[model samples]
Target: MKILCISDQIDPLIYSNTIKDRFSDMDLVLSAGDLPLDYLEFIVTTLNKPLLFVFGNHNLKELPFYRHSFEDRFRFYSPQEERDALTSGAIHVGSKIHREGNLIVMGLGGSLRYNNGPNQFTNRQMNFEILKLVPRLLFNKLVYGRFLDILLTHAPPLGIHDKEDPCHRGFKAFLWFMRLFKPRFLIHGHIHLYDLQDVRTTKYHETQVINAYSHYIIDTGAAS
Candidate 1:
């Protein structure tokens, strides 16, 4: 399967209406976050493929360039909400487990709580958020006979692609999640990279951690 993964910055290549001609061959789309709602909506509408995304820390901030037509400053919906509050036409996978065809995906959005912003979490808060997914993961293991194929998040896992700052620091809980669940791929965004030589992908246990800052393509050979 050919999957297009996007995050952080908006790529003119994908944002252009020509996205259909360029990415028409993609099987699915996964967003790591920090993108405008319009950008996401455009991809979902134009490409006409399954899109799942987690919320970045910036989604809640009031940016001068962003449209205020959205209901509130927040962009992501809670797990308890019946409908998605986000304007993006794609499905939100944050704090949830969703199965797309033969692939199993789990989402954990947000970054370290540097301030009192939404989608930001402290170490304990992030751990608690991860705990909410345990029941679902256990059920998947017991019933579906699988654990996870991808773990989607806004921030990278600790000691992986994360930085030292409080705002960009990776969640320590994510390391535990990867170690426990052993997902084939743990994809994230947040720590932006401008240099080509900077590390992007790393191996952790049986999983491959990818930093999808702007955009990336992944070919999951077979549905495992």
Candidate 2:
């Protein structure tokens, strides 16, 4: 399946109405967060793509951008919600098991410890959340059905591209998952210009870690 993953910045060049045909062929689009609701609206309404996303720390405001009208583009998620609820007016953490063609995917969205809004997590707190999934949902093959095929998060796992800055912070727990589950792919964003290039597919234990940005595409599977 062709997956168009984007995050961290809003560019008129990409989402603008002028760029219509450039993005129309995508099967789905995943945004890691920090984009405006208008951007989401354009993707679903204008670009004609199925849109899925998590909110960033800055997405909580009642921006004038949305004061004029409302569309079903924006969805809210933290750590607790799950499932695909497009018509339910609910949002998820960009987490949960998803199937795309032959791929099974899971996602973790939000930032590390920050004194801000909407989505944020501290290192230890994030670790605790990770622990909740291990043994309980992720590591237990008997329960989670099959091992995950792909892992996606807004922040990259610690050390690869994470930095303790205002906009980027990796989760230590994600690193723990690397050694534990070792899924096929791990994709993330949030460290904008630090390393804006798409990372060459690298392995964490057995999983391939990729940095999917606004201008990039993460195409996986034997066909890729």
Candidate 3:
């Protein structure tokens, strides 16, 4: 399958009216985070494909819709009223596991705790979030012979594609997760690439770690 991965910035190639023709063959769309909800909704609606995304540290105006309880949500707007309010047809896969066809994807969104900002977590806090998914991962291992096909996040893994700065630093918990679960791919976005010489893809253990800064195309069959 051909999967189009996007994050951070909005690419003109994707935001144009010719998007349907330019990426007509894309089977799925995955957003690593830090993107506008309307952009995702546009892609899903135009392509008529499944779009799965997670939250980043920015462009999160509609985050409360996913974080609040059903009762709390009703206070703002009724379920029917809010249905088309934000990212209308897209799915937020943060801290959750979703299966699309034969692919199993797990999302762990957010950046390392740099401040008291939304979508930021400490190393311990991120680990606890991972712990919440252990049962489902183990179940996938038993049933599918693999823990997961993809680990989607907003930040890269520590010491891999991460920088030394606190805000851009990757999570150590992600390294531990990759070592144990061994997903086929770990796709993240947060670090922006300016120079063409900067690396965007890296091989760590059995997983292919990719930084979806502006956009990228993953042809699963080519790698397989």
Candidate 4:
């Protein structure tokens, strides 16, 4: 299937009405992280396709909704409204497994813990989080004959497409994950690419690691 993977920055073409014209052949939308909710909502609404996303090192904030008032026309919603909007239509695949047809997606969100930011985890914390998914992965191995097809995350694996800074540093546990689970592809976004000459795809064991910054398109049908 043709997949449209987006993350980090929002493109002007997508915001404007040119997305449909440019990405008309996209079959699925996978959001790695650090994107606005409204942008994701707009893309999902426009494409009318399944959108699966994970949280970056940021939390969802409330949006301004207008009301029919003169002095205070802006309406502030309660906590429930904020919660509902955060999870309205898009699927949060963090720390879980989701299957779309033949595609088995394993999601683990967040980046290395640096400051007291949301969705940031330490090395130990990340390892603990990944341990929780082992049972389910083993189940998939016994049932479907494979552990996973995709490993999606907000940060890249250690020493692979990661920066030197603590915040941009990849999870050390992710190295073990790739060595063990051996997913067909491990797609992540945290390091932003500014130059066209920078490489985005790398091979780790039998898995292909892709940096889904800004936007990327791939065909899972052609993947082995």
- TM-score, each model? 0.87, 0.71, 0.93, 0.88
Stretches > 4 Å off in candidate 4: 62-80, 222-224
- Model 1, C-alpha of 56: deviation from truth (Å): 0.7
**For each candidate, what is the lDDT?**
0.84, 0.63, 0.90, 0.83
Rank candidates, TM-score, best first.
3, 4, 1, 2
Instruction: Sort the predicted structures by lDDT, highest score first.
Output: 3, 1, 4, 2
Question: In candidate 4, how many Å is residue 156 off?
Answer: 0.5
Worst 10 residues of 4 by lDDT: 62-71
Stretches of candidate 2 exceeding 4 Å from the true structure: 62-95, 132-145, 164-167, 194-202, 222-224
How far is 173's C-alpha from truth in model 3 (Å)? Answer: 0.3
Q: List model 3 lDDT by residue over 1-224, tens digit each.
A: 89999999999999999999899899889999999888898899899999999999998767777766345645666665466555368888999999988889999998999987877899999999999999999999999999999999999999988899899999999998998999999999999999999999999999999999999999777321
Task: List, residue by residue over 107-133, the lDDT tens digit for candidate 1.
Answer: 888788898676777889889978888
* lDDT for each residue of candidate 4 in 140-196, tens digit (9 for 90 to 100): 999999999889899999999999999999999989999999998889998899999
| Stretches of model 1 off by over 4 angstroms after superposition | 61-87
- What TM-score does prediction 4 earn? 0.88
Q: After superposition, how far is residue 10 of candidate 2 from its true place, in Å?
A: 1.5
